[model samples]
Target: MNQIAPIRPDAARNLPQPAALRAGIGAVLDIDLDAIAANRAKLIEVAGGLDCAAVVKADAYGLGAEAVAAALARAGCDKFFVAHIDEGIALRAAVPTASIFVLHGVVPGAEGAMCAYGLIPVLSTPAQIEIWRERAARRGKNLPAALHLDTGMARLGLSEHEFYALANDPSNLAGLDLRLVLSHLAAAEEKDNPSNARQREKFEDLRKRLPKIPASLANSSGVFLGRAYHFDLLRPGAALYGIAPRADEPNPLAQVVKLSARVLRVDDLPAKTPVGYNGRYVTPAPSRIATLSLGYADGFCRALGNSRVNAGFAGQKLPIVGNVSMDMITVDASSLPPGRLREGDFVDVIGGDADSVDRIAQAAGTIGYEILTALGARFQRRHSFSNEGRLA
Candidate 1:
């Protein structure tokens, strides 16, 4: 048998690179991890000597959890929070040394895996506390866990009656090393919502009843409620990933995500021509249109295309024309000079100061977290970091 000779080095050097076959057809979510570190640093500074804990729950708000956690761990973030035990275990695999706090606490049968992975559950109910305490006893030592008390959220955590019962019987906490006592803040973003102080006061009162250990009550928004809410540790989720902590106030966090879509083609329509599904929009005059390779299925909300929200490119606003389809949407590019938009040219769908994630979400009658978490898997993701500041 004769073997083929090896290709010449010069010939191999002339080979074409593998093409990004799908990147040009959808969209790209450019994630700047450096902005995340900056956000953390800002939160730490605002925390006034308190340790900051990064919340990587919801897969780091849909920006890739493992990558986000690893980047944050490198930025001196030793604490991480996840909404589920599975997320905690996965994060444990990513940053082995960091503390992974599972917000949902130990599910009844999951205690074994929880211990095996060295995961800390934020026990919220009496039964959960009892179960964790028994597990600690069975292990013949105290196990690290956090306790969550409900102040006003009325969602998770122990009710006032259950907590008082536990407080009355200190034995309930035995065999467990209580590392943190936290509460959920329902109105941290509303500066004037009297509930912030009410919850803080309630948390303070609850603290007096429990064992003296480090405690936390701050969420991403809570961190901005000032040092009183800071306590021993600050748990910031959305803010670290660039969601504005306060809704009405200016966004203090640096923008971390840039979403861009490539124009697939341009079209011209005569006056009074119908466009898009069901003809929701009709061209009043001769018009120019550019269709982008992104749509509602890609987490670019349908409300954006239908509600007259505009996309941006080189400071020019391309007003969305009609209904957003599953994988495509058309924008009115008639206002721009001819040839301004063409096939393969990228439009800044989520860029510029005006097209910030929060702004777009507001136009869609939602919040930034929804916008961030809704980011679909169709887009190409690029994660980058910088030492001096945000990565370009």
Candidate 2:
């Protein structure tokens, strides 16, 4: 089986502020670097030893790509994927030697920067292919690139007509070294969705016409669709960050994000008193309400207002009540004993349970990916390696 060189410990990055200083912050998002590495390991193992690449696009889903990608590199990951050229440029410094593939491919006239940074581009269109080919010719070298075949997503990648157009005349690819041929699965998470099989068959049919090269058809959820979708390389993004891999099955990945918010204020309200914007929720009886410092401004969805989601405190569920505002959320703490929840105390906004992310996303009528990437800059971010001992 193909493998990376032996794992090496990554040099520690700058540490976060002291707990004393963090106490003044309104919220904190604790990231488990070890969990992320383990998730990558799990994906690799499930892939039956096929190479697994980390997708750190959108700053590793807004959890700080520099730190997350560095940690993965320490755990023996040699390839990383990002959505744009700028993202690849920023991540280049963190994983200096690791293979970084820009998923969005090269923007016109930016091929020099891509080559200068030693970043590979996933060519998704014939136009992109021609630009990369032109650059390779000018440099007098076969520049590395990946071909994306659009099976069903209709989002990016080469369409069937475009792909066959090049396939008919192989000379179109002369100046580029095709590293990998890949596609995106539209509904791998659904498992029973027939589209998965259709896309796989299409990919198989399309790839056979090209020079023998590694192909990737799986994303995070695609990994769970079983070996049929594993292909030659596995490109997983959200799964490494602990998002559930499937909609119906229990999530097998470890939780990596823990979000908590400080209680800015606590109030006691009498029966029938309206709460928050437009009085969406009214107290039925005497109620203790705690105002959390996190709100929609911090990426807590306003749709969660008066939803069934709850703020966690010492295993207690403080049901979120009233509307989620720009900078505050009100949760009913009447169930907690007096003084249990006080000003300055912290409550779990998300990531308390194994499925907290999924649960919260469901309540907000969105997906876990949105919840993660939408997190704003207000929270004090900390990355932990508590599971490092296992990897060692």
Candidate 3:
């Protein structure tokens, strides 16, 4: 593995700090590192001392997985979850000492990489168990792995029949070294939903039947369900990135990702002039409309078109007008105090007081998870997670 070097002084001198960068056609995404650590602390606090495993899958939900994983590791996270063997390999290379778990489990020809990278696979089926056992036996090795029992989600994990079979036959895992027994809650975020209790009961019952193994049964939302849900460890994904685990409460997680776009052109139009495609919005009076560089292609959902969403600048609100286009959205900037707005100025799209992941999702008719994960790849990303704001 190539060793990572410290940031060069020359590079540091040339690069603008996250807050100083100007937003334009090539606006950068500012990732707050201190915010990441704070968010992790909040999650740990909410989990009531349960060890927190950071989920770095989907490129850390499209915010750059390796960078996010490294930041979280430095902040005291030891366990990490990735969706595939390749992700596990990459994360292991990035944070070599961190315990990595591949949620997709073992594939027929992929066991070699798992062993090489020191990754643990979450075994989901009897077939996977048998294959892993055979491979370990052939190699004269006892590979460590975890078992995921399907409680109710039915998406992954062992079915009820498979669970019973494993429980009835201890010899099923005779030569395999099991590390953790885990299950996912289907409706943990929904406070009134009965599925949470149902899944918990099933998971507990299954745990009782199996030989003593450290258990993990919660995701982000499950951690908020209280200490009863915290078994041996808790896996948190969205919460660690600042999205609230529960839908009904104010977010406890710090906002770690911020989106800003530059104003391309500011136009002063006459009263009642239409803006955007098909006259979706018409000014009631004379207005100054600012065209922003971001649109649906940039992950700003088109559903926000014709809504009353506004971007903030210098303590002023610029209301969005007309339909959002593929590359631009016009915002009424007339209310801005003179000299407070400009063509070169940037508008807040996600972070900041005017908009958040939850607010943007509400405007887009989607969920915060989708909004965060769907953040466009075009934006240059500036990641910072340090006490003094520079990578050590």
Candidate 4:
């Protein structure tokens, strides 16, 4: 067998920089774990010292749950909320000491796995409560869990009749340790929306009926609704990932993600030249078009190409001018002087600005959460951290 020769470090310098290769390599997703930690700390401060739990569901909003949960745990975040039992189980290894709560509770016959993994289920229905209570009784010890009350969202949690039934028949909760009672907010982002107060009042009224357990009624936007919604715990998901907490408001959280696409090729097309599929965009004048190595498949929404969005290189805003392809999109870079943007260069499809995610989401006709979670597996993900203030 022939052995390959090893290139020396000095000789390697002549070749394409792996550093450069990665910078211009397809789609790049740069995630700042430190910024996420900082965002959690900011939420904790905003909650006025209330226990703030990190929501790492949907793979930490598609940023990688293991890394995000570990970073939060190191930052002194002891409580974490995931949307599913499997998510909590997967995150168990990353934050062994943190309290992992499963927001969707457990399916029937899966109670053993929840306990085996030490995950607390958020019982949202009478059926789920009965299952947990039976499991606790079988185990001959109290199993910790959270009770979710339906405080106007009407999506999850026990209904008003069920809630009162449980309140009247406290025996239904026997053998289970109800650590927390929580509810979801529907329009916490709409500060002036009357529903917020109604939900708060409903949650308050419901909590009074149950045992005086610590309660949580605030989500990311709820944290901004002042101390009344703060309650005993705050579960913030989107805000931690740098999504704007409210519509039309400045995002105070540090930007945590920067997505860039590599320039694959550049073309010079004359006036009246049609571009992309179906000629959705036609060049009104001679144009300099740079093809990027990302599209709808890479989480760059196709609607963006139709909505007059701009990708950035240096300080120049390059308008996307064509239908988005599965693996490419063309941007008109004519505004920049010739040779400024080369085939190997990269441009910001989603930049580091706080509003970049929301802005692009609006253009794509979706919310930021969808934008983040839709990020495909094709991109190279880079997680970084910095020594900033402590999250505790």
| Candidate models: Cα lDDT each | 0.82, 0.86, 0.79, 0.84
Tens digits of per-residue lDDT for model 1, 187-223: 8889889999999999998888874878899999999
Q: Write the per-residue lDDT of candidate 3 for residues 286-309, one digit (tens) a residue.
A: 888888888888887888877557
Runs off by more than 4 Å, candidate 4: 1-25, 353-355, 386-392
> Model 1: clashing residue pairs?
none
Highest TM-score against the true fold, candidate: 2
Over the stretch 139-188, how does candidate 4's per-residue lDDT look in tens digits? 99999999998988879999888989888977878988888999999998
TM-score of structure candidate 2: 0.93
Model 3 alpha-carbon miss at residue 212, Å: 2.2
- Candidate topping lDDT: 2
User: Which candidate, 1 or 4, would have the higher lDDT against the true structure?
Assistant: 4
lDDT of 1 at 355: 80
How much lDDT does candidate 4 score?
0.84
Worst 10 residues of 3 by lDDT: 1-10
Q: What is the lDDT of residue 32 in candidate 3?
A: 72
Taking all chains together, each candidate's TM-score versus the true structure is 0.90, 0.93, 0.91, 0.91
Q: On a 0 to 100 scale, what is the lDDT of residue 178 in model 3?
A: 85
lDDT of 2 by residue, 1-392 (tens): 33323223345443222233264899999887778888888888788877899999999998999888888887778899999999999998888898999999998878889999999999998899999999988999999999999999999999999999999897988998888999999998898899999999999999999748889999999998889999889999999998998856788887888899999899999999999999999999999999989889999899988847887888888889999999999999898899888899888889772138988888878889999999999998887766541322
Is candidate 1 or 2 superior in lDDT?
2
